[model samples]
Target: MKNLIAATYAPMHPDGSLNLGMIPSYTTFLQSNSIEGAFVNGSTGDFVSLSTLERKNLIAAWAKDKPKDFFLTNHVGHTNLNEAKELAAHSQGLVDAICVLPPFYFKPKTLESLLFYCAEVAKSAPDTPFYYYHIPVLTGADFNMLDFMKLAVEQVPNFTGIKYSQYNPTDFGKCLHFDQGSKNILFGVDEQLVDSLPLGATGWVGSTYNHLAPLYYKIISSYRNGDIEQAKLLQQKGVFFVQTLDKINGFNGAGKSFMRLFGLDMGPSRYPHKTMTDKQLALALKLMEPQEIAPLFNTSFSVKHLQAIG
Candidate 1:
């Protein structure tokens, strides 16, 4: 509910098993660094590859130590309606909100079916806020903003926000139109927050934020304080960092390696997704060492001061 600068968790273990031990440390690390929330079992967390129980366990483990004000947005999306609903019920008290993407395989369909799918999860998690995860490119369901507006007013009163990941800025703005109050539009692409923020987005949900939270906070706060140039500079730096990772085969693998390098015990990404190679690691180290972005990992840097700069 509070303005969130959230990180998408990356489930990392050598055997593709969920490492429960690393979660507490990771939560503590985020809290210590002033992160407002986390999105567990999302794309960055490899939710598609995890079993039902694995996803539930990760959420429970994180809920145990998460700070009171630090919200958790559970990504409860799947082809199975029962599975998604059950997960929504399981996450009722644990998470602040439940985010569901349209059924992936049954896509390229009508808006009616998409709304029905979202409505099921929305009704299941009546108490928790429901945020639609609108990433059509990945799911094959192209949802327009006008349809979302219609649904929000009719079926789902708990429809509090949306995680719009598509690259279209105009469509993103259409999602922000609400007569009652401001809808929480969380930008899913980490690199585009600079452009997205001024358009009325209050929160961000992205994988890279797991390691780059400090920089993100800097950019968001700068923009909020009316320093667009400063925010743009920081956001540009973030895009450059993301572009560097783009050259690599996997972002999750590269992100975990970055976390490990900075001393977080987050292990290697699960199997099928290879860990960063020596060559890739060497390039990442070089790109991340520059002072402009290096402060992300520096313990001495104050998040408030970084927000105020420029």
Candidate 2:
């Protein structure tokens, strides 16, 4: 499997609509700066708010612009299996893999239900590599890593790996060590890549990677190459940036605003998710400027470039 430093989504317009035009430039920026891949229509993409067609459009647009070697994982998860399956089918030839979070809203009455859901999804995306996305905090379903192992090995034949998003390093480590043969465990916390790497995390999927791709690539590359000190320093800087956003009520508004500052006309976030004020924007710029981090505002690269690098 190709290990990668991947972002979660392309930014959206202020009206909360998909900003298709920004994708090519954004993918180019990722390629020029060493970002290895991206995961679209995931939580960071606000999948919950978008319609199925919109999600398909986003995936199609990305597939068109993304470098062939730049692995793209489409998050086709939905509360309804039919909808999720439809999206998965639509994205079949468009992406490298398909990641689906466990059914949300409805708590599974038994392990069988969860396993059944996985089986269905696996059946739907027969040709696509299917990864189980476990983010218990958001879904209210606490899926133990052991249970997931059983589900993948015995029940879900097409299941290839997981995007473990819970914040517990030990759990992530256990999952990574569980079945290293065919199962891949991608660390989902942006701020914990350095700590997670040593524990056997080969890939990562996170929201902050959208704006911090260059830095993330540097850290992951350093760790993979045995440059521990460099990785640690980069991780420290990442943690600092993450903390800064946390202070401003997390990355919701701050991430979008930072995208705007970088020149993607990604409009403000939708209502219920407030957009940053002038003071907040000032604070964000001040916090990021010293780090010398330039957002990929208008760069363009093709999937061919990514394939060549690979």
Candidate 3:
């Protein structure tokens, strides 16, 4: 939570089965890029598409291979309350923390009901720190997080804070200052990260961090160094990076496919998410090169190709 925590992709084989074998390499890649942790089974992992057993298996694989220092938060959210608790219980000792999105389908009508649901899931993993994944756009359960946290802290003993993914900076800023900044309110929007920094956002969880950690770190350093213009410029690159991939194919699939540029073949996107063709991928790289963004990709990419473009 101190720095960037990647919302990891679930590696799959061509057949779309869980390619858990790729996890060890995935871990090394993240650590190499200085990503603080992995937020598994979240949006980027396509968790809803994965079965309960598949989600459990994915967490187990990450836990088994993750380096001692790597922080892993298993997103054990399920529409079914029983299954969510089951996954929470399963993640007890394996992960550094456990996270749960509000059940998206039925949707919680009131903050009290949302609190009830979170408290139930949190108690299932009593010993592990619990985080409420507040992504209202997808969940359709939009509650004021600052108000919810005021109640949640009193209700749920293990409730650490929120993964505030929505675009409400005023509320996000309030949540950050709640109780003099006691809770860990991780900002979830990548494009808005630089803006969030001035609002006291220290931690972030996003999919872009997987491919562009170096660029982001540079952004952070530039901001810290008082180079505001450079920071803004770098952040715009991030925004453009996401937009470019999103244009080639849906960003979720194209971005995951872009991992191959780092030498980690994360494989095809499952149903409903388009996998980029080789030509599409080449176009993605081509699009990034002129923006001066390609140079910031991981060193694992062919230096020759990068230089040739340079």
TM-score for each prediction? 0.88, 0.85, 0.96
Q: Which ranges in model 3 have alpha carbons more than 4 Å from their true place?
A: 303-310
Once fitted onto the true fold, the runs of candidate 2 whose alpha carbons sit more than 4 angstroms away are: 221-230, 277-279, 288-310
Residue-level lDDT for 292 in candidate 2: 51
The 0-to-1 C-alpha lDDT of every candidate, in the order given, reads 0.75, 0.74, 0.90
Candidate 3 global TM-score: 0.96
Give the lowest summed-lDDT range of ten residues in model 3: 301-310
Clashes of each: 0, 8, 0
- Give one digit per residue, the lDDT tens place, for model 2 in 214-296: 77778878988999998998777777777777688567656656554444545666554556665676675567667654342
lDDT of 1 by residue, 208-297 (tens): 666677888888899989999999888888887777776675666676665654456466667566577646666665766673566665
Q: Highest TM-score: which candidate?
A: 3
Candidate 3 per-residue C-alpha lDDT over 1-310 given as tens digits, one digit per residue, 9 for 90 to 100: 7799999999999889999999999998888889999999999999988999999999999999988888999999999999999999999999999999988889889999999999999999999999999998899988999899999989999988789998898999999999999999999999878888888889999999898888888888888899989999999999999999998898998988888767777889987898887678778777877788877775566555434434
The CA lDDT at 237 in model 1 is 81
lDDT of model 2 at position 198:
77
